[model samples]
Target chain A: MMDPQRLKYTREHEWVGLESPGVALIGITDYAQDQLGDVVYLALPEPGGRVVRLQKFGEVESVKSVSDLFSPVNGEVLAVNQALRDHPELVNQDPLGEGWLLRVRLANATELNTLMSKAEYERFLHREGG
Target chain B: MPELLRTSLYDAHKKLGAKMVDFHGWEMPLHYPAGILAEHRAVRNACGLFDVSHMGRIALRGQGAAALLDLLFTGEIDDLPLGKARYGFLCNEKGGIIDDVVVLSLAPQAFLLVCNAASWDRALGWVQQWSPRFEPVEIVPGREETAMIALQGPAAAERLETLAPGLSTSLPPFAVTSEVVAGLLVTVARTGYTGEDGFEFILGAKEGPDLWRALLKEGAAPCGLGARDTLRLEAGFRLHGQDMDEDTTPLEAALGRFVRMEKVFVGVEALREQKRAGLSRRLVGFTLEGHDIPRAGYAVRAEGQEIGRVTSGTFSPTLQRGIGLAYAPPRHAEPGTRIIVDIRGRDAPGKVVALPFYRRKQGESSLASL
Candidate 1:
């Protein structure tokens, strides 16, 4: 499946989609979830918490291993996916949509320019030989 | 590091879109397209096939074979009837476990050892060191020429019965027998790692891929070692070097019953002394509260003190809770005793529980007419 072209990506395989004028959504990429095997739990920051660009904000633990989730841009957490607390499998089934990790009020919206597009992210995954 | 070795079923696993990982230097499948959770459930519900050729298989033959085994093993081997299998451990002189293994009596003078691949080379060294005393015993390392497959689940018998007629109902638990299926001669043992009624097949290496494909045609879901780990964890089986190491005695590893105290074996004196003195720390089962997954090396606390560390832990697929085994101080080792696990710095509430985390209803999980 194609990653939505409108989304921006991180080298660590997180995606950021601008939801509104300075608000964006975040979640792991499909490749990230597939590599993790089976999502069992996620430890995400609560709303109102500040996150820095390229900083670890959460973790995704699967049946196989745990991976850190990094912030794609500096922002204040607007909301976290409460449903994922009990149903983390959503990250494996629909990572880009229903499995979105958080909504952030972007503090440095210019940071989006530094991120990769859908095609660039696909090329990065290939370069990594995945 | 050395290049990883591949089993006979490697191509078959790749054909199923399996994710291969390095397991003790062997390139083994970690999971298939269904993932570990689904594969674990499939084995608990229907049937799951596994390529377990990575386990070390060494055959001992000749007059001195049984005696050689009797002295090396913690349990009595002479009383084991022909075609029967016995579980025991290879222990050092200090009573520490080297490896837990299964010995199958192929004939009056022949025995087969199914051991952990991680322990194969070291365990073989110990055997050779003692072989000269038991002359005429042939230590044949057959792992290179053989392949093992495990078919587990409640439907294992019925599904396997379709291919090998009359085999399911006839083979009893812990029994080993020979059978011919799909033109391959396989030694079928009614033994398994999962807490289910199942069978393990040892056959020629060249025929492993064919047998795997044939089982798939019979509706067995191909499983990988990832599911195998969860299944064994729920079953309360100890993984070599993870759950127990050379420093952990059989008694401390919750394997006291496997060590026959009266047996004249290498580690008997130390075990006898430990039995007299007492266990300082006991390997026990514990369950954690919601979303608290206790992983290996996590601290286990009791009475506001860090008393031990978890050895094997996981989120139980069947029990739907966090379950694990850890070495616990005696006061906190009893069932229902309150304990806490330090999960990455968060102290999560837990309790000492009896193994295994999941138990099949009578006559379930195996083909014992279920």
Candidate 2:
């Protein structure tokens, strides 16, 4: 589990890391992958696609069902994790590292303030009773 | 909300930290902490134990029992020898499948019908309605008093022999016998839904917890419905509600072999007529070329036109690929035929393949007699 202090989280279970000025990396949280079980496929948007905060960008499919992956902040997709096409299990094995879904050029750096801190996300998980 | 029914091993599942889900009103374990993937692999490579008590068990006893089943089911059940089982379907007069069942002929004038859990009430009612026609035959519902556990995989027989000595060795495929295990009476049947050698034990409901623990102690991994579904799908077994329904005929479901044409049974005339006219569509199996998963209700296409729909689809744990069964027009049902599945609006390419996406290597024990 990655320290929630270093990353911001969305209520829909995605995590965001501001890598540099105007750039961010995103992936689903450990809690999300644990709930989804073993992921078999991931459908992601192509590079150069624009996304808005809380917008549906792609989907993560487990053996049992599919869940929509929601964008946490507005951005232009710089690249998707192409390794996921052949090894979706990485989402279950290394959700914080190799399982990272996308790298993006943030449209608005201020959008990060609206997201929850690691402490707040832990409380949110507790409240959800998961 | 209505009360959700639970099986005898409900507490056992909870103790193992299994994730429970409601399956047709039955509160059952969907998977355990090891998850579906590991549970499925356990059943294929080693052995897994499943609590199958939710499935309906109906007992028929009387001089007219065999005769009544022969008329009601599509298979020739009257001549089924004692201690053996036969797989067949109960069809409506129109030849549409009501339920696919397995009947175990326990003795003369006595038999047991095991039907799907979801179809229990309807199947029992259908049997009761026909019971009067065959005088002296009694239709007894046994689910409340009985519990069942399926021990399945390549190592199943070896694991079973350690618990009930000589029981697994004495039984051949599709054979059933009553034995006393740990001072409890158990009806051991050499049968399973997964494409592997295994046995299903039917015993007193109260004894379920004890046997479940004993099996676990003997190294049998506790599995849940998630593993059961993937295993059955890989074996090319058709789930009743998904693969066929009251509106789908057995002929269209590609289960014609289970139907005996020489015998008089419900829907025989309709099946005979279907044979004469030829089926317009038939069930076919396919494997996706890539990682995209085909799911139930997904449209199947050929030549840019919608030809059919997927009945059951899943990522086969054993084959490590996407596989499914679908109903397609006869022209598109042949092996090697090209077809595309509409996965969330995108067309994913796949090709029709032979039934049973996985078969155990030669010299492995046969799982089913049929």
Candidate 3:
């Protein structure tokens, strides 16, 4: 089981944490990273690209399959983890911290209320069973 | 309804925590807890065992069996000596591949044909259809009575030598012998899907679990369909359904060498016609320039025009590069030709290359000195 204390999560298994008021850090959950092993490449959206809730923002490639990254909240991309461009394994190594995929500015502050809390995310993880 | 087809070693696979998936209508294990990369590495560096009982096994025994088999398959089956095996294809009336199979000449008048499980019904029906004109023929319904296991990698021989004791050392590539491994009656064949010097053992269903445990105890890593796919792809071997289907002819798939027109077969005329007309599309191997992994059904583009689609693709663990096979236009099928694969709405550059990205060293007794 992964600790959900440090971040907020989406039902679709993405994690988002507020770096600042409007700026938020995002990456996949530990479960998601484990499901997609040994990430080889990551294609992130442009820094200024607009992202909407439940929409595809980028893609991650592993050895045998490729998975699409979905945005959890309506936001505009402020920055992306360029380190992932070469060493995508970072996502597998530290999904909660250094492996953060992108930073975005949330368009609406109310979006935070709908996000799942640590306890809620744990329940969700249990329900989904990874 | 989703029907689950279980192999002889289903309980053993479940005990090992294998991720099960539906493959060719069989509930086969995709990988174990260690995962595909680990299993592949184990098979490459050490020893690994696989349950391939899902494959079809048929027997042809009669006075005129050899003559009848020569008329059915594309390869020279009659020429195969007793106890030797040969790879061949079963083609349809229209010259398209029905199944790619292996024929083992167990005796002068008896042969064992191993085919893909999914095509068992069709192959059986085809043989039954031709049986009246030939001689007595028998088709085994399922491998349920038999349990198949593969011991692969560089150290596979040594491990087998220790486990079975003298049952694997004298074996040469493609050689077959019925020997007792772990006190179980098993037919050990020195042939495998991975491009490694290994052996594939066919044993009884009741003895499968005990044998699997004994093999694991002897350091044979448990592999699954995932590693099997990567290994076979790297070796440039074709999966029956993906590489060549009912619509795809053997000639178009670059398997012309396996088809011998010197003898009569079911689809000889159509294949001859296809050869005369020239191939429109051909199967080719390619590697993505970057880390983008092309998948099955991804389109292949040449100069902005859709030429073909990838049939099978995966990141080769041994090569450390994304590799795939596709049916592309004949013009772009040549080695060193460049093409772009549309990977999730983005174009990734790929180049055609010679197949079997890897090959194992020949055995000591092989025709070529190693």
Candidate 4:
């Protein structure tokens, strides 16, 4: 888990970290990575592609099953983790730091307020009976 | 859902941090904390042990035992050499496979059978349906005393050699022998589903946990059904329910070599007739065009029209690619034929290839891949 005060999350379990003035770094939370054991492939959106809030942006395929990745807030894709194309295990090894999936420039910064904080996301997972 | 049945190793699996899942109404370990990919590598590169107690084990011993097995199974069980094992199928009268079984000739007029856990009940019912004709044959459907375990990989023989010296030298590959392992009398068979050379052991359930622990201490990695499925798939082994059902014949399933028309057995006539008439569709192995994974129930397309469906598929840990098995027309079954896998509305291009995406090299620990 990262520092509680700086990170924001979505109901779908993605985490967003403010990297610069309007840029954000995003990746799935630790809970998501554990639920999906052994990530194998990722079909990520291309750079400069516009993404809408709470909409499907890409897919993450594991050995067990495939899951849809939802954008936590509206943004334009700046970059994807190219290393993940060959080494998806990084997601399971470090979901918060090196395993970051995307670099997106924020479309609406207020959308971050709509997301859950670190403490709230933990409570949500607890309430889901996981 | 009804409560799932637990094996005797339920506690041991929990202690090892196994991810439990339902397999044919029984709770079994799908994978341990190491995950499926790592476990698969362990079996390919070294020794891996698996608890297969959920599989059905049936024994028959009497004057009528050979006669009983001869009429029910499709292979020549009576003439199966002593201390040898034969792979064959139990089929319905229409040549539909009921179960693929391993027949072990224990003694004169005595034999043992191991079958898939999913099809055991049906196999037992088939046995009961015919055993009455072969009177005086004792059938043991629930052999509560024996626990089954599979020790697979190249280093498998070395691990067992530590338990019983001269054990590997005495028995040939695909052969069986009885030896006391760690003070427990056990039957060890040089047979496994993985492409690697390995052994499957049958021992008393009471002492199973102790032996499991002993092997773990001997550096054998504990594996689960997740790796087992991938290993079998990589080796081009057919799954009972997934690959073939009562509606699919042996020839259509590409298991023609296992069928013996010279001998008398159930469904021999249909198989012979089909052999003469030729097959309508055949089981074929293939690899995906890219990293895309193909799953069961996905439509197989050729010439832009649906032809068949994928039976079993997975990301090959050994080959590092997507591979699958399907039934398609014989023309499309040939190698180098173009095909498409309709994966969730997106047509992923692929081609028909040979079975066994992976093979073990001679005297090598690693797998030889395409």
Candidate 5:
């Protein structure tokens, strides 16, 4: 089991709000990365691109499958984690912190309510069997 | 929860803390503790051993077996001398590949066919239906008492020699010989899925654990299905069920070369029809021009039009670039033709190229290199 107290999360297993306001961190959760296994490449949206909630903003390709990274909230992508370009395994190594996929400029604080709480996300993971 | 089939090496895999996943009903390890890239590189640089007991092994024996197989299979088995192996496909009534298999001729009227694990049932049924017409055939299902291990890499021959000296020197490509190695009777063959020099051993199930341990001790790193997939992909080997199926014909999948039109098989007529009609889609290899790794089911688009879908894709550890196999329109199937792979709603530029993405290093004496 991964640490549930490190960051807030979404029902889709993406973590949010690990950084200051206007520069909200976005990444897949530890449970999400573990399930994917041995990530090989990432297809993040270009910086300054607008993303809508629940829409696919990027992709994570592993040896087994390709997973779409859905946006948890409406925002503009400020930056994509460049470290993942060469070392996609980082997403599997540190899902919440150094492995963060993007920094988003938050458009609305209310969007956070749609995301699952830490405990709720944990239950979500449990139900999904991730 | 979905059920996963377990091989005899399940416990051995779990002991290594392998990341297990269901692959064609078998609970196989996708990778071990070190990770896919490291394990993949290990295979390219040194030897990596894999447990491939999940692959189906059927022993075909009896008078008229050779004639029956000659009529049923796509490749000519009559010419394959005893102890040699021939790669062929079991075609359906319409010339579509039922399953790709390797037929090992043990003797004139006896053979052993190895096929994809998932296609075992279909392959067995096809043999049973066709066997009675020409010869006496015995269909042995769940013959899981045998374990197959593949030792693959450039250094495979050298490392394998330490365990069983002269094993590689005596065995030619696609030929097998039975021997008592490590006090166990093992059939070692110079064959592999990876486009590397290697050997595959078929031994008793009870002796597998000891052999696996001995290989590891001898410096062959334990590689799982993950590295195996990447290596085979680089080698341009097709995976049944994914790359070709009952609905997919050999011609469409680029396996037409394996199908001998001169001989009559179950699907000869249909294959003739398809050949006359021409294929709408053709399997092609392409290199990802960017950071994206085009994965299976991802759409292949050219000039904003969906042309095809990827069958297999991975970041090649040897090339350090993304490459994949896909079936596309003939216009885009030609090598050097540019296209794009729609990776989760994003179009990543790519170009069709000749396969295999990686070539096996040739020795100075090999005629192909010269």
Candidate 6:
């Protein structure tokens, strides 16, 4: 439940952390993992693959159903969380820390301003009745 | 929107924080706060209770009851002893399965038929349409007034004994008995859909919540349909609409034992013709090599050619592996044959294995009796 004030959020329940200039670390939000239940498998995008904002970049499969992982920012994948291959439950136990999905070199840093802050995202969730 | 029906224990499920979902037209619990995995493990290791009130219960009375049931079901109905239950299928004239049901012989000319929830109305109609053939019979549908609950697992008998004295010892497998629990009359049948030793209670709808609370007080974990599906799949039990349907025969569904061929029934001629002509496709159990979950409607292939399709698939909590049932061509249906299940878009390697991916140890006497 790491609702870091600095991290940006999306309506689709993804989070983007500005790791460095023009680079970002992205993972599904704590709310997303809580809704998905125990994650059994993760299909991640390979490094050097292009990812478009608001598009499906990967998938998270629970025992009940599969949910698409939407990208929050346009970028090229620099690295994926390889450790998730052996232990998918990391997404459920530590979704914000060890469960980060990808590190991407951003295509447009200006897009970060359009994403919601922690307070705004919390309000959005409230508005949506979640 | 049409109104959704709720079971008598609906408020109890909500109080327990169960994740509710629409099952057919009934609002039911898909899983509880402990989740599907824990619920599944509880049933396999200890005991679990389920609200199965949505399933249809029909009561037949009068002298024509036995004859009517005999002509409708595939099994021998006339010879069933009192206080015993038998599992069988209702098939159409084309030998296709209509529904799989359990018939409990309550008395000399009285019986109870339990059917799947989704097929309740259709099954009732089928029985009603054929009732004229055996006149002077009373067909009473009991969905509105009755509720059903199942207590299943290896420890089910022990847990049940705490509530009803002499129930575990006196009631053998497939036996039914009437008892008074908490001042409410209940019909306890030693039968279950899950491949475990358990009892299904048919009681008044008004008394369902109290019984549910009583069972929980006796240390039975509350389970949902999520665990129910996986448990039944692990036991190699066929789901009516998935494994067999209006177009699939009992032989193709690997349920030949339940069908008594010597009897004259609705679909006897068609089944006899199928036996003479040989089955084109057969249902087979399979196991994946890894964690890739094979799901229903996945394409099954052999030697790079599509041979069949998966009917039911799930990650078995007991086995800790992916297991499924598929309908394959006769050549590809034998055990030990290698096959590929197209999961999502990737080809997952698997092997055709024997039915029942899980079996209780010998001398366990509970599930082994099934």
- Deviation from native of the Cα of residue A129 in model 3, angstroms: 8.2
Query: Which candidate's DockQ is highest?
Result: 1
lDDT agreement of model 6 with the native: 0.88
Top-lDDT candidate index: 2
Instruction: Show where candidate 6 strays beyond 4 Å.
Output: A4-6, A19-23, A46-52, A76-87, A93-99, A103-107, A118-130, B362-370
Q: Higher-lDDT candidate among 2 and 6?
A: 2
- Stretches of candidate 5 exceeding 4 Å from the true structure: A1-6, A17-24, A45-57, A70-80, A103-123, B1-3, B272-280, B302-306, B329-331, B363-370
Better of 2 and 3 by DockQ: 2
Candidate 6 per-residue C-alpha lDDT over B68-153 given as tens digits, one digit per residue, 9 for 90 to 100: 99999998887899998888989999999989999999999999999999888888998998999788899999986988999998
Assess each prediction's global lDDT (C-alpha) against the native: 0.89, 0.89, 0.82, 0.86, 0.82, 0.88
Query: Candidate 5 clashing pairs?
Result: none
What would the per-residue lDDT of candidate 3 be over residues B243-275, giving only the tens digit for each residue?
Answer: 789898888888888888767899999999998
- Decreasing DockQ order of the candidates: 1, 2, 4, 5, 3, 6
lDDT of 5 by residue, B190-240 (tens): 778887777788888878888888888889888899899999898888899
lDDT of 5 by residue, A12-127 (tens): 77888746756688899888887787888787899999988888887788776778889988899889989998888888888876788988898996778777888888788778
* Model 1 lDDT, residue B104, Cα: 91
Candidate 6: tens digits of C-alpha lDDT, residues A1-130: 3448989999999999888899989998888887877677888889999999999998887777678889999999999999899888788778887889999999999999999999999999999987
Q: Which pairs clash (backbone N, Cα, C closer than 3 Å) in model 1?
A: B197-B365, B197-B366
Docking class of 2: medium
Task: Provide the lDDT at A59 for model 5.
Answer: 79
Q: What is the lDDT of residue B369 in candidate 2?
A: 53
DockQ of all candidates, in order? 0.76, 0.72, 0.50, 0.69, 0.54, 0.46
Model 1 off-target regions past 4 Å?
Answer: A1-3, B363-370
DockQ of 6: 0.46
